[model samples]
Target: MMLPGFPEAAPLAGLAGGLLIGLAAALMLLGAGRVTGVSGIVGRAFGINDSGMSWSSAWTFVIGLPLGAFLVATLKGGFEPEFVPLPLLAVAGVLVGFGARLGSGCTSGHGVCGVSRLSQRSLVATATFMIAGIATVAVMGAL
Candidate 1:
C-alpha cells in the first residue's frame, strides 16, 4: 500500500502538519471570527451560498489549499498519496458532502474549533463522525 515517490511514515512531519492546521484554524476563528471549515468554504466559493465569508475571501482560502500543498510538495521534492479509483473517490466525496451538511460542519469547524470551544453540539457531531469513520473502516476491512 506504499504510495509511489513517498518515503516511510514520518510522525514528526504529521505532527507538524497537525500543529500548523490547528494554528491556522485558531487564527481564522480568533482573528476573523470565522470557522476554518474547508467544505463550507469551497461550497460557498462554488455558489453553494452560505452566509458567512464573502466569495472573494472564501475563494482565496480554497485556492490557498492546493497552492499551499503544491508549495510544500515542491519544497519536499514531490508528494504522493495513496490513490483511489476515481469512481470510488467521487462517491466518497458525495457522501462526505452529504454528511457535512447533515452534521452542520466538517472536522475543522466541529472537531478542531468547536470542540476546542467546548460546544455540546460540535462534541456530539464530532464523536458521531469519528465512530462512523471507525465503523466504516472496520466494515471495509471485512469486505
Candidate 2:
C-alpha cells in the first residue's frame, strides 16, 4: 500500500526503518542482555516475573512509543491511522496481546530478530502469524 505523502520514498523509508530497528535491537541486546521483544517487556511491566530486571525500561519503552509517534506526527504532519470504536479496539487489543503472549513473541521479535538468527521455532511461529494475519485481513475485507 502506498502511503499518501511518502509515495516516492517508501521503499527507502522502509529500509531505513528496518535498519534503525535492527540497530536498536542489537544495541539493546548488547547493552542490556535483553531481547527487544515488546510482548515480553510489556508482560514484565505488568509484574510478570520471568526476569529479574525492574519494569522501568519496559514502562519507558511502552510509554515512549506513542509519545514518539506523536512527536513525529507533529514534525512531519502525518495523519494517524483510523481506529475502530473504542470497545472494538479494546477487545481486539486484548485478543492480539494475549496471542502475542501465548505465542511467546510478537512480530518484531519473531519475524525480524529471531528469524535473522535462524531460530526454527521463531521461523514457524512467524510464518504462522503472517499467514493468520493475511487470512484475517482477507476475511475481514470479504465481510
Best by TM-score: 2
> Candidate 2: deviation at residue 30, Å?
0.6
Residue 41, model 2: lDDT of: 75
* TM match of model 2 to true structure: 0.84
Query: What is the per-residue lDDT of model 2 for residues 18-128, given as tens digits with 9 covering 90 to 100?
Result: 898899889878888877887877778888655444688888878887897788778888776886899998998899798887888898888877998899989999999
Clashing pairs in 2: none
Return the TM-score for each candidate structure.
Answer: 0.83, 0.84
lDDT (CA) per prediction:
0.88, 0.83
Q: Name model 2 segments beyond 4 Å from true.
A: 1-6, 78-83, 140-143
lDDT tens digits, residue span 1-143, model 1: 65576656765688899999999998988887898888888898999968488999998998899899999988988877789999999999999899888988898889988898899999999999899889999999799
- Among residues 3 or more apart in sequence or in different chains, the pairs in candidate 1 whose N, CA or C atoms overlap within 3 Å are none
